[model samples]
Target: MHGLAKNHLKKILSTCSANRDCEYYPCHYNNQSCLWCYCPFYPCEDEVLGEFVKRKDGTLIWSCMKCNWIHKPDIAAEILREITELTLDKTTECSIDYLENRELLMQIKNKIEKKLGKSNAI
Candidate 1:
């Protein structure tokens, strides 16, 4: 995603880290593996987004049936909503499974605190 604000990245990191239960899944960026799980809420039927079982090379495997709506999200807005339990407007596009795990959250917390200092509100 381009045009990502600094605050967006910060938010994504924190919210994803809120869930320490699951391990972060790896991603492919710049032709390399980037182990960063990017989902916040627990997996459920409601959150039953879609499934993609691709070959090890990331090729498409198979699929079932679901809505055809395709929308990319903003990692920042999503994290803020997930962790803080706040709702964002529909216009707010948070990343899907971007800030998903606790490590990402800790990272965001550290960065925010470092920038604004310990007394600053995130």
Candidate 2:
């Protein structure tokens, strides 16, 4: 938690809401958390979780539509917690950096891998 204010952490955590009314509700799973409508780790280019798809224009883009690792409520909460702990500045109450923190990114990848196991089940 570092020195992050309790209220601020709570505020961040509160954003992890499940919107069931949306047309694309349950986009990944029966009870997936809609915390990230768009993944924070887009273009990760991780073969285990995603891959490059060739579009009609022959442009390659990373596609993670089948990856549901982050949709799990617990996983989403943990990721949010880790990100806040790593990026939030206690004094300024601002997020100084996010993806630039290699350690944090690695931690997230390792957690995803551990959960996915050898099969990489969607």
Please name the candidate that would achieve the greatest TM-score relative to the true structure: 2
Off by over 4 Å in 1: 1-94, 120-122
Worst 10 residues of 2 by lDDT: 89-98
Candidate 2 Cα misplacement greater than 4 A, ranges: 1-15, 90-107, 111-122
Q: After superposition on all CA atoms, how large is the RMSD of candidate 2? A: 6.0
lDDT of candidate model 2 versus the reference: 0.69
Per-residue CA lDDT of model 2 for 1-122, tens digit only, reads: 65678777665554576667668877777777778777776666778767899999999989887777777777777777767676666433445344656666776757755764423353
lDDT of 1 at 94: 57
Q: What TM-score, over all chains together, does every model reach?
A: 0.23, 0.67
For residue 85, model 2's alpha carbon misses the true position, in angstroms, by: 1.1
Per-candidate Cα RMSD to the true structure, in Å, reads 17.0, 6.0
lDDT string for model 1 (19-47, tens) is 23225321212211111233232221222
The per-model lDDT (C-alpha) reads 0.36, 0.69
For model 1, where is the 10-residue window of minimal lDDT? 26-35
